[model samples]
Target: MQTNYFYRIYLLLVIFVNAGATVDSNEQSNVGVKVFGPGWDNPQLIFPSRYFFVQHFSDKRVVRVEIEGKVGENVAANRKDCRIWTQVFNETNFDFDMIIVRYKLMSDRCSNGVIIKLFDANNELLMKKETSTAIYAEECVCHNLRWNELMNCDQNSEIYNQLFADLRTFNNSKFNFENSLEEMKRRYAPYTKSYSFCHYAIVNNEIYRKCYGEYVGFAQFMDDMLISLASKTRLPNTQLIVNLGDWPLSDTRRGSIAMPVFSWCGSDETFDIVLPTYEITESVLNMQGRVSLDILSIFGRQNGLPFNKKTSKLFWRGRDSNRLRLKLVDLSKKHPKLIDAALTNFFFFRDEIEKYGPSVSYTSFTDFFNYKYQINVDGTVAAYRMPMLMAGTSLLLKPVSKYYEHFYHLLRKNVHYILVDQELDELLPILRHLIRGKQYSAKKDELPASDEEQAAIVHNMRKFVLKYLLPSHIYCYYHKAIVEYSSLLKDGEIKVSKEMQLVYTAKSKKCNCNKNDANKDEL
Candidate 1:
């Protein structure tokens, strides 16, 4: 009884330090489902074994940094135009080196600059530095490079030459970029609102957006993602969400959205880290720059196979855009026993048949989950279907990929998926061993290392994904990201900024349910 009393006191202390947040419920707000009787956040359910892991492990899936001091912090302070809050700012903590203060700029307004001051034990200002912001053209870096490559642009091509150009502009220009979705598009670039929806926080110095990266056009899909989050979230102290997708990776510089994410992709001087799109897994099909697509739903419209049972053969289907898909088709012709690869006509529009031809019948995404193995190859950019592919029953077989999306760090080679390397020479042999039950030398084979290790790889991977890869977990993580970002400000209020990503007063607006009418199920 006495220990319980002490524990309650400690819990109260932690909550009080949270500025003004109140813990009204054990479960996080609108997480759809809960496994641990109102107490389990998404990270806890997805990573039940990883207790020592810091808060918000879902957002840190693709990016993990090791720092000496405390890596994650929650802060609350007051500043010039806004109340500064560091809800969940991440920084490297070195013991003796020059303390470098790095964090994301989360605000409801366009911050001209930030002033950091270092004080000694006596509280005297030992050092102070003023920092400014950097602006870029609406496109993410990866989109431009890939776009130029497809157009067959030589060095003289506008996009090719401008690929690495100094497109960085400063706030010194004093551009009025903070306008509503329609207003910004009409005045500047027609695509401004789509690319800048999550571009910046300050819209007319009133609305505050959540965050932004390469494809600000993802704002709509992000809105739907947030809606899903809202349906299931039940936590209290929830800030009004207003996630317009109009921010940058950081204000100092711009980089590529090549794989929606990657390791060490930050530019020099500005240490802002860019995040990938969540649309990869949910099939949101629209594009602002790359030749690929943006999807609205997390999965497809069919009932998928359960994990315990699936066809033994590997299954893959898509348009022929690169050597990866072409090779898979060729190999399938040679070895029908292992792979079921084929080309599907992917005419985006019916009029295209005049220039192209009859479209090949594309397989339903729901069907892929029924097979024991699914091929994940790069098309236009990183394969956006990876999240769904891995979540399905099929064990993923991808080439050794240099490109990556947000949650790549959560996966392990030969465990979550098999890697077909550059030459891809061993693709057939590996397929034979796994699907046909043919044995290969332990040292020569990549997966199921030895004969004795037949089920270990699959079992381990299945367990890891089953725990962490749920839409509920994604929603829970999303809510936590906003909460952490909101914590940086005093009282986590949005009185100073414009609109938030998931606006707390969202009901007043007409919500468009991402038209995935075919997909009846919710994540």
Candidate 2:
């Protein structure tokens, strides 16, 4: 009996030793942790099946999605081509800081790319952009920009360091502007004399700041009273203001809504005001308000400045999203001298057999800015390039767009952008008008004349962007808007859902503000 007991104890000890050894082996096999999150040094223990978001993001509002397949099963599914799956998450109520997704790429080569499509709570498609998963075949497949360290701007990241410096400077200084309200109104006024936009907050019965963001079509003959209220926000108030840097989730969310749109929307509970894209929806500022010029792309290359050498022909390059652009291509093919429109990525238009060309290699902003006349069109909603185009040396020509940015309200038809039809039926006629009017020539590499009407228009746009589109000015606008919106809320506080607490930061958040602040010098 004693011998039997000893034998049993020995068997149990052997099993425990084996289990410990297996765990050690698993830990030793882990790799590729520094490539992901806040830790920047932790090893990732990747198993075959489960998806893993970085620790920094996963700790916040992002949640890893669970797939109903093993590594082997996922491999089998993706063997043919890229298999895209759209999962519907409740983006409306959750104030998640970020949304990170990881999946298995059943492929031997790591160069394959995966596309993720986001949908609102109602199963409406929002936007679809592709991401590279070249490292997927190595460790894990993840959307690099989604829920990674790139989105988080903390002290650890250079972006965060810069932001912190800005915050420090902002917090250190007392709110002071050299220009009075009336002076600022005049100084920052847009090019069109009729340009009018007001932003104030309404509290109880009185008005604080007087507007959230105003849309004015006609000239504002009246001036805003510059009565300054407390700009510092208090947190205890049930009502808060939120600024969203994206368009809304769906058009269906009629009244006030709380949505989760990646990083642009802050924690649902953090702010009372939210920014996103909205056509008719009331009570939200569009992200376009905070959009900034990519300083690197604009300044890195030698561009055709105003009064410099440029082609007289109108130039435009973009993906085929609207029929108008495709029509533009068709029209341009007929008049190559006047219009220079070409497709860079033709994956979508593969089936359109009518339009085919040898892919031309061209740089982005440098190529577009080289033309005296620039064409603007909407892709999905408001095109982001319009502001940059307006800032360019080119004379603006665009279709009458139903969509508009926050700044578009102040823009006049001829002064800001020449409006055209979406069908571009009059595109050729407009080019003819330019040619006949001697505004531009239909010759390659021919620059516009100094005395041309188009040249004057180009001058106004460049001046407006250089003067009013400063990063400091934009941040002040955003900060003031938030202050006004928050104080406007009453006891009837629209409670942000729990999920709205997720931390999400917009890509332009850092750039939209003081990119050239003195605080950055300290870093």
Candidate 3:
């Protein structure tokens, strides 16, 4: 019984061994992928599923595969082979979106060449690829399985849709935000009121002298007159008092000495003084004579005067002409600095003329003669003829020249209309009563029958000057001249007092002396 059992066992063993060999060969033949290159252990064949390696192969049908990462170099290849077996099993059994192949260069061998070939189950070529460079020695032990291929399965995936939508929304939001900001700025700009005041003062007075002498005193006088006429007229919201060409040279001259001086004064503030460039040039010409004309011509050219245009008169002529004079007066009321600049030019011209002779060719004699003589008399040689001509022309032109005549008439009418008068004995008593805190009252349309009524009117007038007009004038003067002149004075102390005295003396001499004597003294 023992012998019979042993014989059966031996026969069974042989059958089992033969069956195993048949199964292994069948698996190798069924493989649809192959690899060939240096550094492989088995050169003739490779079992892609089993991870068999080949040392070298010449067939282009062979595919290259690279192993990466380490499990102890040689052992790493075996471990990766095991992992690949599992991946292959899963891929073959279930649906896979795609496969990703990971490769790494190997550097152990002189030429670590790799190649791979893929075939269908029927042995027909599906793909073929190769790599000339080796997997780096450090990376040769890494394991890689195809993952990127799986991403290509669906074009309309949720991840891609979300990314595109977010990108579009981000772009649109930025565009709308910018447009809203621009609309807000247009909704809030200040209201600007424009009007021109007629500035009038005696000629040759300094700013301070005029301010104290004429402007302040005139303002008081005008206030009283307005109060007297209050029953017939209403007060203006704001008054624009323009200083026509002959504005005082000083705040004191205009009677601004008692007013409080504020630091922030300019066009943006209350009062303004405008000086004409022509007036300045005229003054300069008077002082320096003909040589000043050349300086002025050069200056005019630099200032954009049309030097070559015959239709356009010479700079000084165009400037001193009646049209320009009126314009200058208008512009001076609006822009005080321009007037100051004109005056500066005149001063410089005068200085130059005084240093040079009148016969010099700074400008043509005809230009000077026309400006000084012809225009003054309207081409009449006889004094009596000129005066008669002027008077007759004035009457004739009154209707036709309404605009010019209106301003002229207004000026003459207002010239004697004192806005403020410091010298008025009546003014001092009224001011004194107000300063001493006198209580006064008045009825609508009632003339001052009592001392208290009179005091009330004076107080109101004084208050108007202090609150509105004076501040504006002082502010304008400081910005326009005081600050600059103060800086020019050595030690930064304004020589206002000394300058005032000189101005006063000059005015007195001008008023008392004859024209010829005054001219000689000025020269």
Q: Which structure among the candidates has the greatest TM-score?
A: 1
- TM-scores for the candidates: 0.44, 0.42, 0.14
Query: What lDDT score is found at residue 154 in candidate 2?
Result: 20
- Arranged by lDDT, best first: 1, 2, 3
Ranking by TM-score: 1, 2, 3
Residue-pair clashes per prediction, in order, are 60, 33, 71
Clashes of 2: 33
lDDT of 1 by residue, 1-523 (tens): 4224323333332231121111232432222111111111111111111111112211112122221111112222223222222111122110000111212223322123334333333455433333233111111011111222221123222211111121222112322222222333332234543434343232121223454334554455554444333322222232232223323223222322111111112232332222334454243212122323222121222133333345677888887555566667777777787888877754333454443333358776766756667878876446656766654445677776545544555677776667777556778777777765676554355566432243334444444433443333333434444433333323332233443442323233232222211212212
- The lDDT of each candidate is 0.37, 0.37, 0.23
Q: Is candidate 1 or candidate 2 better by TM-score?
A: 1
Tell me the lDDT of candidate 3: 0.23
On lDDT, who's better, 2 or 3?
Answer: 2
Per-residue lDDT for 157-191 in model 2, tens only? 22122223222322433322221223324422443
